[model samples]
Target: MKAVVTLIFLGLISIALCAVSIGDYSDKNHPGKCNIDGRILPPGIHQSPTECERISCGDNGFAERASCGKKMIRNCIPGELVDKTKDYPQCCLRYFNCNGEIVKA
Candidate 1:
């Protein structure tokens, strides 16, 4: 019984440790490469293969992703909102009518 309890506890601990990684690609895993959808990207900003996120792969072998910064409707006169139906950058890039002028943001 004690042996079984110890094995179960060890297994739980291992599972918990695996769960702690939030899927961030690091140098420890693939040095200087951002592996997105099985395609290796060098250290630089690149578009995600499966999402609208802009991935920035640092030289340190870490990846940081960004999409639309924030949706701002202030001073926008019926400006264009994000069209999720579109592709990568076009999906997030929006045009706004500010002060009666069309502004691309």
Candidate 2:
């Protein structure tokens, strides 16, 4: 009985440690967003209307600003890339009243 209880306790502790290691607990300011070295990043594509404007969360976890009119804007989050045409099709593609939706053009 003692050995069984000890094994169960160890298992629970291991599970808890794994959860903590893999959980998203960095962003204390913004929920559901990643806080990479104190910068909060959104999930989807972030855009700026002005050219040479500095985006808040650009470049994969590097806090770099991507220029407007570029073909692709690097997302701060890992494994995410935002197409400038899709984010701002009006400016890049000459479409009128584009809603910045992820749609097939």
Candidate 3:
């Protein structure tokens, strides 16, 4: 009986650790990446009108429309890129987990 109880306790501990370490990534609502739009986008914004519109959406309360978009641009800058075609600035790259260390992409 003692051995069985000890084994059960160890099994529970292992299961708990695994559950805590594994996270869901399939959910579209999952937190990831950064969206820089309107007023907060950095220099060298994209040239596509659609991109521009997306950025402007921020001013029109679009920021509150999508949770992920809002999460991405909450602190981003909206602006034109240097060539209007280059890559926009990345915001999520600067974030990390609870620890002060930076998480690798």
> Which candidate has the top score in lDDT?
1
Better of 2 and 3 by TM-score: 2
- Each candidate structure's TM-score, on Cα atoms with residue i matched to residue i, is 0.41, 0.21, 0.20
Evaluated against the true structure, the overall lDDT of model 3 is: 0.30
Task: Give RMSD to native, each candidate.
Answer: 15.4, 17.5, 17.6
Looking at model 2, which ten-residue stretch has the lowest summed lDDT?
Answer: 72-81
Q: Number of the top candidate by TM-score?
A: 1
**Residues 1-105 of candidate 2: C-alpha lDDT, one tens digit per residue:** 999999999877544432111224235457556564454666544445433233344233323343323232233222223344344323233222234434222
lDDT of 1 at 49: 55
- Candidate 1 Cα errors over 4 Å, as ranges: 1-24, 27-29, 69-88, 93-105
Clashes of each: 0, 0, 12
Native-to-model Cα distance after best TM-score fit, residue 76 in candidate 1, in Å: 17
Clashes of 1: 0
Roughly what TM-score does model 2 have, to 2 decimal places?
A: 0.21
Q: Which pairs in model 1 have colliding backbones?
A: none
Model 1 vs. true fold: TM: 0.41
